[model samples]
Target: MASAHHSRKPSGRASLPRRTTKGPLDAVDDPSLASSRHSPLPQPPQDEASGSTAQQSANPQPSIQHAQQPSVQVGEPIKEERELSFLFDTSIYHPLSQLEVPGPFRKPFLPPPTNETSVARSLEQLDALLSQCEFLRAAHLAGSILTSGTVRPTDSKTVFRLLAVRYSCLELSGNLLLAAQEAKALEDLSSAFYYDDPNVDKAEDDEVLQPHRVPHHIMPFSLRLQALRLQSIGFSDPRRGVSTLYDTAFECREHLSTPSTTPEQRVLWTERLHEVSIWVVNALIEMGDLDCAARTLETIKPGNSEHRALWTSRMILVRIKMGDMAKAHKLMKDSEFTPEDKLALESLLAVADGRYKEASEALSKSEAKADPSMTALVKQNLAVAYLYQGEVPKAKSLLEELINDGHSFQTLTINLATIYDLTSDRSRDLKMSMISQIAGLQKDQGQSRAFVNADFKM
Candidate 1:
């Protein structure tokens, strides 16, 4: 059975808004629109005045808090903003050694080509490597491209996009420490340095500084979020991610407030605001501050049925986590959840109250399974309920099936390993066999966390 720490929550499979543009480059070329939150490339220009420094906004460091923008007259020339030096740093690149990779996962390697085609070709190679679960190779190739001098510092959009890819590769390869350290090279993402605007002095007022105009954020939404997450985990500062989420929410608000903002952009910004707000609550909950999470959840206004469903679901989970079953029940009862959602909530409540059989039965209903992305989560939870009901063999078989079906998430793998310990004296062999199978399986995308030795309890 999965322990309380490992229990799966009904996330409702929340996702950022889809990009309308083909790629980050397309978003960059269009200055009037903000890129969708889910875009892999750097977001287009946001309001420069509204951009909040990561350190100041996240933690209120005194130096950054007291920093001031240059005072400018209507026609005064805007002195060139300080150049972002890290964009040119070559030391960030490092050779990828097979010895650095975990022994079981290592394979034969080839150094990526060093030529004009390297950066473009390496990006394709990076995608292919990640799909093949060759994360180390991808990480190395990304580093090589970053330092190859093919990507110019003047081309901030391209640089930012590649940085995001490099950061993602390091993170997905189980190199969180390196990822965090490497992220430092980005410096303060919200600094004026990233928002170079030659027209700023020509603007008579902040109205001209609206989000719909030129000069959007240089860093994409995903990279900014990733940077904060890494900072929180790498620095052991729990509040950093929460703070960053709030900054994102604030930025979204700024975009929504601009009168010139397109109807479509406004809709995207509003959706992003709601998503970031939910992320804040989730971060707080993960930090074990359920009271703060609940309070934060109360302030987010859902724009539609889908968002309302997400808010309602998250609130109930937080209340249950706080051991306030009556509050959770009341919240669930008061809301008009879809039949599927209501059934899922009832199952959650049942599990919390130790009624494993009831929870299992509720989750079994076809009406309770709606979101395809959430199916694996539901099945995993059902397996845990079976274990709690003393159906050990059933639980084991269910978890094994999940792995075989290409869903060897870390928590599921650990639970399976735990089951192996209970069912056999040769748990190590079973774990080794499972690891081999998992290592051989190709991942479809970056959604799954990278495999680590510790996940098998080795």
Candidate 2:
């Protein structure tokens, strides 16, 4: 929900050699991808019957055959110009049966346009659908446009943007598995084949490569981040996620270290590196490599005191999760965390130590609410502390108030449903009523209004 100021370019200056970090995801170590950077991908073995047809179809440009002429040998420049534009297969637009989506979210109240001709209008409609939290419909429409064979092949920016939207909507609408499956289309995105470097020959002479010489052609950095995560999850390979994130971080670092990088680019790459490091830490944590996660956390140096304090607080929590309570306490004592962060840490420590009343008191402090970002988290913790202190009614009332105020967080809804099950014989009716009330809530044009049945713990 927060805005990122980083440049969305897919690749940093290609001449900057990717630096490898000792982290959980070692993408540079993958033989399959590492070997791809220097050479063209091996063409699949083809039979005589279908190879020519496939090749011709693959390159719709008539001039594609010029490279095969006798005069145009390997390493020789062809006289004719070739269209190297990339296009997605039409198969990606296959009809998505409504039966595939969850029943409750299958049909949107406002249907998406099916035969829109204008790309601009279709893009507008897609944004409107997403704003209304009509994710499934948005996903369908996005997929249609992306794979419609209508967008110009050279317009990589728009193509990847739509891809990101389609994947994002699918995941947000609770079709994570489907989104992951679709992510396989983005294999080896870091391969040099995707990039167009007109000045690539100069690299052989050890010349200073200008950034503008290598324009980005791969998916936007944001989409690449999400896609890599999705691919790793879908393929059941957590290490892949870690490695790819490390690879991206390496690229960011390379950009930061380059003297030719503009001040704007330096700042953007710095932020991107920080974000990538955070993702690497998360991937490490998910992989149950807590020590690696801690090591990775230390590599991130935030630009501001506020960010530093936030990261230190996270490090303290990681230490706690690693069962090093003494280290967690010592880190907290040694660091200069903001008052809000300190209160949050203290409450977390108290909860871990079974001091629910103390935790509640700390979270109830005005300082705990100083940061709007921390407010919901503090309230959630307070509710948990209330429940631990045997004040179920108070906790229930607080959660209900949060819900009534339009904080439709899944945890809040599920916790409220659990309380209903504990206190009432007709909990199902209560949950259904809650769902109905949520459905009736007025959603703003650009706000997410989608809700799934699972949010109520059904």
Candidate 3:
């Protein structure tokens, strides 16, 4: 980990867009992320829900809502305020970059926080904006990485930020394109994206690796980017996208695997636990490989208290969804899941038994202990649980608060919105208006990645 302490330069200044070019140091080259002595490889930022939610509520797609907020008559003024802020943010993009992208990317500051709390803190205003097109973004990204110096993060802040940049880029452009197109040209032009310069391998033994340059996760990401870009540009296929992701997953698992067995295995075990426990399960679910992912749970379960409980709980959710209550119960008992996970497990069981009251109570207990996020998740689940119990408003209210969090978990949001629709007795127009706010919340949060990008130099 390296600390990124670039000379306190002004971030997100309004500069005329740099002309994107092909070839070395152009659209593809990124200086901010690279290697040191041609090193190891890489990683998605988070688990956004898909198009379905177990919970339903009235909601509209926020993308549609964003354009209409200013004129809305019924919604909260906060949304209107956010609209103003978003437009201001959007305006900066017009004057800054020749390459178009979402305004947030061009701004030195991150996207505006959806919740009201952050507005009081130092939310630096945006200056530069980017176009939303994929190719220009791709080109800009290549150049940014090259000029940014691909430096190793010496601290947690930089590491998180480095990871964020990697995550953000992949989120926006995780597809491949025709090798001959401008986007492809941008992809091909990036030397930094190459895990390593082949010529480096052939350089005279005396000609050592550069002083502070080596591709870390850069190469793996580059490989995926090329593949993903192709997918983005009408490649007429998903096979490549799926293939690249799994390959990347394999590489990630390999990079994370331990070499030897010893007491150190304990530490390695925990690290691996965090990887699969916190991310792999959810990531797999998002990728629609839940069944394949479930098999990996056995390996992921390790000798740690929190992770062990989280792992067991996650499996219980899978089993519940799979309708395998028997195994879910057995594991629940065997793992002796913590109070929270146990409650999650029990709630699922209660739901099947038509014990709605028991399910709600159990879910409440589980949710009581969750952090704001886990609490929100529990709340979203509560919406479903309530719907199961025929308690629609309880479910609706639970989702409404969750909408405040505006999680991008595609499934969670969709499920919540849909459930609200099913459960609510309100008129169609009223429901749509309310649900649309939640959607906007999700959209706002998605654009504003929480991973603070800290610049790090070796």
Candidate 4:
């Protein structure tokens, strides 16, 4: 019984694609590939002609647009070209975070690391190899260190040095994007200036991770994820403070792209890629592009049981949106799911037929009482069920319970406020963004004629 605003459409579960090396990252890294669109040729390269060449001698001048190769022409169809370039393969680890393999996937997809006799020896070997290779090799060496899994809280400097060298290479080559991605991974895997010591004056005056300046290792991946989310929802301009995040994401992609192209490197990159997918889905939903969200899910291959169920459940939401119950059920036939899972899914489908009782009964019979956060989610759904059954008090109780538990960041807040018209308890200093969002949903539901951010009224 979730609130009406948070409820699902009557469509059956969606069937998402499997997780192959060529999945969403391929699409995400280059969005142009996602479409059936085409693009004009790339602008000329800066070094196309040198001083001794006749062409260079005659021209004596490279046009401004040539100087700025990928200029943002107002009406030109650069979208597809940009998209394709964006989705270019990193050739790193084919990430496994999005979909679980049915059987245990213990195989090292990456080139197995050279076995070391001891942790200290592995560190020594990594250090010795450092001065002999390029930045990517250095980054690759860092991966080897991680693959060894012994680079402890103490080896932070070693990891940082490796990434610094790798980023330096990208900077030299004018590939800032890839540099940013690698820098981010370095930051996440090892961050410093944590709020742990005494006599450190950890207040705002001495705060480390400030906006104008950011320690390299932490900025990149988070910003990439944030930018992807913003782009998913069609927000061309994110607010002011997020510029660093944008730069980091753009740079990180470039920094990591070359090194990750090797088969072994792709294997190591999976965990971070999975994280990116989850964030992308969230952003897509906010932008209300359900089908595009489904498109992104195409990368999650369901080659085995665990993977099948995980992806099936995700697609089930899509099918619900698509309103294809038969296909949804068909997708789950071989999934070997439990009776409770089936019931919850069926009840989810029943929401379309306006059968609130059956759906609620199905969910209630399942074991959703174990985890507190999950329990809160179920309660939200139950609230929707109650509302559907025309049981106002029951639904209201569940909604109130959710608010008390403090999950005001989702549709949970938006839907309830829409239904109540006015709630007994009001949020103090509510965000204009959230309020404006609720107002839009209200208008869409034919409940209000007022606009939120824009003044357009229906």
Best by TM-score: 2
Worst 10 residues of 3 by lDDT: 58-67
* Candidate with the larger TM-score of 3 and 4: 3
Q: Could you tally the backbone clashes for each prediction?
A: 6, 2, 67, 54
Better-scoring candidate (TM-score), 1 or 4: 1
Candidate 1, TM-score vs. the true structure? 0.71
Cα distance off (Å), candidate 3, residue 370: 5.0
Please give the ranking of all candidate structures by TM-score, highest first, separated by commas. 2, 1, 3, 4
User: Tens digit of lDDT per residue, candidate 1, span 1-458?
Assistant: 11223222212223333323221111122334343332221112111111111101211110000011111112112245333335545665555555544456666554644655645676677777666656666677667666665655456555665666666666555566787777665544554444435446565675556434433454555556667766676667778666656655555655555555666766566455544555566567668888877776766534345446555666676687789999989988888877776776787788789898998898777225557766666677677778878999998998899888888765678788988988899999999899777766643433333455666776
Per-residue accuracy of model 3 over 307-400 as CA lDDT, tens digit each: 4554565667666656778887787778765566567667767887678889888778777786665666777667777887888777767766
lDDT of all the models against the reference?
0.58, 0.59, 0.39, 0.39
Task: Tell me the RMSD of model 4 versus the true structure.
Answer: 25.6
Question: Model 1 off-target regions past 4 Å?
Answer: 1-85, 88-105, 108-113, 203-215, 303-306, 366-377, 403-409, 437-450
Clashes of 2: 2
Q: For model 4, how does the per-residue alpha-carbon lDDT over 62-152 read when each residue is reduced to its tens digit? A: 1112111222211111111111111112332122210221111111222324554455665455444343222233334445544454444
Pairs in steric clash, model 1: 43-220, 45-215, 45-216, 45-217, 46-216, 46-217
TM-score for candidate 2, residues paired by index: 0.73
In candidate 2, what are the lDDT values of residues 15-80, reduced to their tens digit? Answer: 334546663222223232222212211121111111111122111110101111111111112222
RMSD per prediction, one decimal?
13.5, 14.8, 16.6, 25.6
Could you tell me which 10 consecutive residues in candidate 2 have the lowest summed lDDT?
A: 61-70
